[model samples]
Target: MAVNVFASATEAGDTAVPLGGSGVAATVDCPDLSERLTTVPEQARPDVDTELARLDEQIAAAYRQLQEAARTADDAKLDEGAILDPLKKERAGTIERIAAVIGKAGKRPEGLDTLAECTLRRTEVATTDAPGGSPDQQRQQQNGKGEEPGNTGNTGNTGDDGDDGQTGDGQQPGNGGQAGNGPVAADYADINSVRPNVVQAPRQKNASTGSFATSCGVNAEGLFNSDNLIAAPGVSNGAHHFHDYVGNQANDAFSSDEDLAAAGTSCADQGDKSSYYWPVLRLQNGTVEQDAESPGGGIEGNAGEIVTPAEVTLRFEGNERGEVTEMPRLLRIITGDAKAFVNGDTNANASWSCTGFEDRQLKDKYPLCPSGSDVVRTFTFQSCWDGRNIDSANHRTHVAFAAADGTCPDGFRAIPRLVQRVVYDVDAPSLQDGGRTVPLFAVDSFPEQLHKPVTDHSDFINVFDEDLMREMADCINSGRECGPDTPPGSEPGQGENPQEQPTENPTKDPQEQPTENPDASDPPAERTATASAPAVPGQDGRDDGESEGKGGGSGAGRNDGQASAPPAQERDDDASPRAEPRAATTPADDTPDDASGAAPAPGATQGTGGGEDAAAGSATEPQATRGGLAETGSGLGLWPAAAGGVLFAGGCVLLIRSRRRSM
Candidate 1:
């Protein structure tokens, strides 16, 4: 029997097919191949081969089952009692521990895992290499684990464990760690550690000259001592103490040049500083008046040019009408030109040549006039003269001086003229005020022999008029006579009426209403009618009832009450009046008529109505009482009562309807 076996093409092609020889007969084609097989183990080797193939199939099925189990375990969702649960938990714990270690390290530590492995390997090596060590040594070698020498892997060397309880370099992780470090100190020690370059800052140059000696001889603390420094003359110390410069100079030298340059640039960018120069006008009279001018074509002595003072005269005049008119007054004299002298050579002997000429004809001739005289009186007078307009044509009238009234002689009058002349010299010190030069010079020297004695008068003489003084005294007396009793009009008490007894009736008397009806429902209306009544009750309670009678009783009271009631009814009937007038009259609106049909009893109604009318006449009647309760009840009056009731009831119905709709 021919057995058929499946084989690769290469093997199949290589299989030998025996050809039938001469002695063998050709066999028929076998259709039932299994029926032709040999039944013995040697004839068919199917058991061993089949058994091997079955085993291979079993192994493949087991591997597939194992793979399916792995996939299920890895699934995000799993049954509660799955066997992989503990293993999954252990894996997750390991991952979390690894993350925690990485987080604590901040940055990954290089070769950390390799170092740990090397350390464990070294421990293993130690355990194997050092067998007979002490218990401690053995424990150390084993790394606290009782494992075989070659089994354990390396763990890294001990390092600082961070705040997160993981091994890393010294610092803790995150912002919390930085805050926990606390504030850095600002002292030299701390600052040097952070910025060592700061200690290398150059020292500032000393600009002080030490003068004061301290207990330490010369205080080495000259940095803060202002007395140790000599400042240039004329330089301001800025304040009483000059020590402030020490700090300022130190800052200037130590601060960055960029900062100083920035400040300087800012200042320079602000442009020129504002200043003021007052216009000065030099006057020949020695008075520094504003806008005064020098005379043209006159004896010129450098009036406007800067020159040294040779001689100057100062004149003082007194108010002739005052008690001090006789006193010799000290005066200040100034001059524009300081180069022209009176005697040409007497610079030191200069004196007032016209001083005591008060008694001579010179006094009467040129009393107030300084021109055509040998010497001029010097005096300062504020003038609105302009220096640009002064010339020889205006010289005589340019300089003027003061004198006694009517002291001018026959044909003379006070006129302005040159007084003291100045002689210039470059060797002399320039005239200055404060620290600035005066810019103008005064003449030097004068003729001393020309001086004379000035007339003197008694200093105690009263120069004022006595009659004028008496008139002033009378005015003061008259002012003092005015008292609280004085009336506004010229006629003291006559213009004002005297206090009088209050009459039985005042002319502008308040109209009184008649007695109201005890049964009136609306007493306010009744009272109003009574107030308008023509007749009123008399003192005797008699009712004359006459139209002309001022007072009456019975009939008058009835008429007054009747008359008062209609106007009130008319007021109540008017709808528009009730709306605005009621609001104006009664703020609280608590009146009986304000409520719907809520009238008081007969007598109570009249009383209440009268009281309300009076309150309405005055200020502050209650209006709120009228509108508030009117919705719930009928009102007392005609139109207003009905209208208010309707409005209130309508408002209530609307509110109810709205509530129903909301519900």
Candidate 2:
């Protein structure tokens, strides 16, 4: 996203869309409900009430600091909006956290009225004294939108206009709970109670069971990003962070229509090349620079992209009854909201658990895997299709989940559900790597994430041809265990030796069909086999799509027949577990091993910002202090100029609009 110098300076009218719409941050604030709390006498509140009250004060304080920061930026008139961008984002997050806790403090008394959600009134300073600029040369002006959180009922905003903060009840009831934002801000009880309303009702179903799955390419060495999926519309590999892909060798952001036309695949079925990707989870050592933390760790700058996982397994879980009529040929999904880290619980669609740790299944915070257990990060995406539109306005409305009995809801049709399990073999700690213990905080898994910590999310784009997609749907509704070689729980030919990695090649179907390279090494035509079919609608905003409201943008990676049993779920592992083979994960090398490793994962390449450094992949490269951002030549540093232009413009418009109304 570059600065539109020409448009800002020469245009006769303000753009209907903000100039920096694609550039800087969002405002996530909700109307303040302080006065609403007056109804419940402080004395009658729960022990958590005092904490909520205190957080409110902090929210107010942060708002003030943000105001002060805006003033400082306005005074200097920095060219790039980068420096102040982060400060503003962080402050906004702090405010939202307070709001989530307040909202979760439970509803206020029936009539307790709170202060209308506090609005971060915009402020502007003249292009007064910008550095290195003469009076006439000062082109940059700073505009402040304050903090707005995403919409969450009546809650406050994060960096943009916040969502209504009301719970399923859509109201704070009566000072019954806190009244701010995010699930993280509230406790376990609240998180469960506020399961985001699945706007699309589950479609009804009669039978369950028919579905096919691809084998996981346990060989971490095979990971790479190549454009072979939904092309034309969405930018390929646009995720700012690196991604780890599993299915479909030739699938990525830049895939062309022809490429998707070819029926090549990485699934056990020869033609089921659906693409799946999520951010690469890196190890953060409190020790070195990159490994230590985002603004802190890593050797040269940060740490080299650490080693690939020891193993990966991909299998489809089917409904119990029988198969149905058909499945959506090409379905796409992105699991979780973008701001989970900052807002907490806002879209708590994440599940953290250990192989042998079922008792602590849905704990809010990631729990430690027992000594020999693997740290599993499981993400689920909604699969019920409206049967009419392949994609909905919000990327979710058209899709809903099937009931436990495997039936779709009233207006919805059941599609095969997609569940991804990202496993890390970190139980046997390696001091050589970053000092990260397994089961670390996910979401913003990076210790100091660009936005908020534990802000974990994932993206997908289906490039399957119509015929193959139809076949896949048939496989699902028909209850056929699609993969001929590897089915769920049955690792073909490896008879119960649970420890040894599967020797099965994921690049081939059960028939041993050769696959095109995922590293772009193969010739374009051959590698990106294409077909002439309708393109699948893009997923959530990891790339450029549309609005996230209504039925568009991605919704939370969704519901299982029912929410997983909460953390207290009862289950015991083997009294004493047996040792499993430890995967020899590659360690971060100080030297650049350009020749090693797979192609950089999606978005971690050049052009997208220098993100695809050999060091970032190749199992060894310069440790990047800034991770993907610095690699891409993108940092907050570039935004000041752009931010100045947009904010200045927004302020002017608001002021003009206000004056006109008054007249």
Which one wins on lDDT? 2
Relative to the true structure, candidate 2 reaches a TM of 0.41
Off by over 4 Å in 2: 1-206, 222-237, 263-265, 286-304, 319-323, 343-346, 403-407, 428-454, 463-480, 486-663
Q: Return the TM-score for candidate 1, rounded to 2 decimals.
A: 0.11
Least accurate stretch of 10 residues (summed lDDT) in model 1? 117-126
How well is each residue in 160-192 modelled by candidate 2, as lDDT tens digits? 122222223443211211011111111111122
lDDT on C-alpha atoms for all candidate structures:
0.17, 0.32
**TM-score top scorer:** 2
Question: Over the stretch 343-456, how does candidate 1's per-residue lDDT look in tens digits?
Answer: 111111111111111101111011110111112222122111222222112122222222212122233332211111111111111111100111111221011100111110
Q: Which ten residues in a row have the lowest lDDT in candidate 2?
A: 539-548
lDDT of 2: 0.32
Q: Candidate 1 regions off by >4 Å?
A: 1-394, 397-406, 410-663
TM-score of each: 0.11, 0.41
User: After best superposition, candidate 1 residue 637: deviation in angstroms?
Assistant: 70
